[model samples]
Target: MGWIYLILAGCFEVVGVTGMNKVIKNKNVQAYMILFTGFIFSFGFLSLAMRTLPLGLSYAVWTGIGTVGGTIVGMLYYGDSKDWRRILFIAMIVIAVMGLKLTSS
Candidate 1:
């Protein structure tokens, strides 16, 4: 389904972003490969979902997923900040994404 593709796209987006961080931190060629592959799959899945989903709604959901996922990844692996404010904002984004999905026909 379109939603499935969209979700997968978001997951891959996180992978790609994490890969980019890895590449920068360690200059690993394998990380670069992951970056390339993850992005390619991310966009590919996003495009597939766009065939049926509304553009604005789909994009917002995709970016919301990527933003939240990337933030969590940063906190978990890269030692990024993890405060109440950050958690609250991430929750808001998740709520917005859920709202979009629920409101869409």
Candidate 2:
């Protein structure tokens, strides 16, 4: 259940970041709304998860997942670079996040 919150937090972070990009370009009103709502939900869920989760571990997992998620969102939604090296690094981030979660769990 806590892990579910963390994953949802990551998804919300991705939505927030991608919507922020669109909002910055003044290209999407809906994305702006999504951005605002996503941040609210992400933080809310993270706060809830923190109730039972260790601060250091939760923060690390949250940040790592969010970073990878944001990068993928950037690439898919904004046509950002998608080179092999970048993908590999993102995969590493996922692995690290998973390792941390597993170790901490």
Candidate 3:
């Protein structure tokens, strides 16, 4: 259940970041609303996840997942950079996040 919450939080983080880009592009009220809503839901799920997971492990995973997810979304949807070097760095972050979970448990 906690894992589920963490995953949901990560997904929401991605959604919030994507919505933010949309809001920036069009500068519409609806986009801002969606972005704000996504942020609220993301934090809600993240808080739920903290109940079971260690603080450092949960935070590392949450932030790492969010970073990677947001970068991918930006690259695909917003025409952001997709260079190999950047992708490699993101992969490292994912590995580190996994290591934190494995060792913290």
Which candidate number has the best TM-score?
A: 1
Each prediction's whole-model lDDT (CA): 0.96, 0.84, 0.87
The TM-score of candidate 1 is: 0.98
What tens digits encode model 2's per-residue C-alpha lDDT throughout 12-92?
Answer: 887788778778888677977988998998898888888888888888888887899889878887788999999999999
Q: What is the lDDT of candidate 1?
A: 0.96
Candidate 2 at residue 46, lDDT? 88
Sorted by TM-score, highest first, which candidate order results? 1, 3, 2
Q: Listing every candidate in turn, what is its Cα RMSD in Å to the true structure after a full C-alpha superposition? A: 0.6, 1.4, 1.2
Off by over 4 Å in 1: none
State which candidate, 1 or 3, has the greater TM-score: 1
Candidate 3: clashing pairs of residues: none
Location of the lowest summed lDDT over 10 successive residues in candidate 1? 20-29
lDDT by residue for model 1 over 27-98, one digit each (tens)? 888999989998999999999999999999989999999999999999998899999999999999999999
Model 2 steric clash pairs = none
Q: After superposition, how far is residue 39 of candidate 1 from its true place, in Å?
A: 0.3
Relative to the true structure, candidate 3 reaches a TM of 0.92
In the range 25-95, model 3's lDDT, one tens digit per residue, is: 89899899879988899999999999998787778888888999999888887788989999999999989
